[model samples]
Target: DQQVKQNSPSLSVQEGRISILNCDYTNSMFDYFLWYKKYPAEGPTFLISISSIKDKNEDGRFTVFLNKSAKHLSLHIVPSQPGDSAVYFCATQRGGSEKLVFGKGTKLTVNP
Candidate 1:
């Protein structure tokens, strides 16, 4: 059973625009939301994360928003660049657990 889902398999955005990637989870026990970016031939790298208690977290041009009541989360990138093009994975982790449950991922393509 897929606990986490990225409904949109792919999203395309113009360079210098905003990119939004969405995810939903069925497990309410998850207390952490993690976003990972993976380029071709490379492993997924941690991009941004948010705690269940927090509604939003921002790092540089990336921001993650969590809606615990909806079990939904989104990652937004402002002024998206070509380098931002990658497969984004949405992961959920329960408090104190090292295990991460990941969604299939959404491919983001930023055109210049």
Candidate 2:
């Protein structure tokens, strides 16, 4: 089953603009949602995350919003910078589980 999906394969944004990445999941039992950024040939790095119990979580310029009703989650990057360019993956894990399920990925490019 395709539990997680990223509709957009790529997104482009100009520096100093907002960048939004979207993700959808079919599993309601998922307790946590995470967004990871990966550079080419490099391992994915944790970007931001949100819990199912919370509607929104923010850290600096990155914010994650979760809508349990629609089973949707999105990551918002404000004033996107050139350094923010990378492939983004959406992931989820249920309670008491160590395994993480990830979507294919969405490549983000920020142009100066």
Candidate 3:
């Protein structure tokens, strides 16, 4: 089946700390991986992405690592800020199109 899994429904961290979110997939055909962040009443916005050919990708305070052999991926946010408090969704796409299969989502809370 085409299922993306986010094991933890929520994570709490103090400001200026690092926040890590994990995702897993059962389908081997998934070649593109992406992370999206969402605020209340808003659609998810793309955070970071990595292709199956790459092991790591980073953008500013966000970094995404993909372990293709393990079919696992993770998103890391450094010096987590109050602005980072939101729902994070992990998504994967098959080789054909960019359509995504999303996880339930992980809520990240950054304490002041």
Candidate 4:
């Protein structure tokens, strides 16, 4: 059983619209949460991350929100483009640990 989970298997969003993805976890030891985007046949690429001590982190068109009390988090991509279509995985890193525990992932399709 994985500690990180993405309940939604897939998401569809129109281009230039906002896309939101959700994730949940059961591990309290995780001190950092990250979102990774992966294209077919390629490795996951880091999208955005948030520290457990903070509630939100934003970068360019990506934003990550953390809710420690609820053990939940979300990723938001504004003005999503067709190139944004990919599988997004929610992952966590334990304090002082380099290993990352990843969720099954949710496939996001950005329609043009």
**1-112: candidate 4 lDDT, tens digit per residue:** 8799999999999999999999999989999999999999999998889998899999999999999999999999998999999999999999999999999999999999
The residue-by-residue lDDT of candidate 1 on 25-57, one tens digit each, is: 999999999999999999999999999989999
Which should have the higher TM-score, number 2 or number 3?
2
Clashing pairs in 1: none
Per-model TM against the reference? 0.98, 0.98, 0.96, 0.96
The C-alpha stretches of model 2 lying farther than 4 A from their native spots are: none
TM-score of 2: 0.98
Segments of candidate 4 deviating more than 4 angstroms:
none
Hey, what RMSD does candidate 1 come out at? 0.6
Q: Give candidates' CA RMSD values in order.
A: 0.6, 0.6, 1.0, 0.8
CA lDDT of each prediction against the hidden true structure: 0.97, 0.96, 0.96, 0.95
Clash count for each candidate, listed in order shown: 0, 0, 0, 0
User: Candidate 4, 25: how far from true, in Å?
Assistant: 0.3
Any runs in candidate 1 off by more than 4 Å, and if so which? none
Query: Candidate 4: lDDT of 36?
Result: 95
In candidate 3, what are the lDDT values of residues 9-103, reduced to their tens digit?
99999999999999999999999999999999999999999999999999999999999889999999998999999999999999997689999
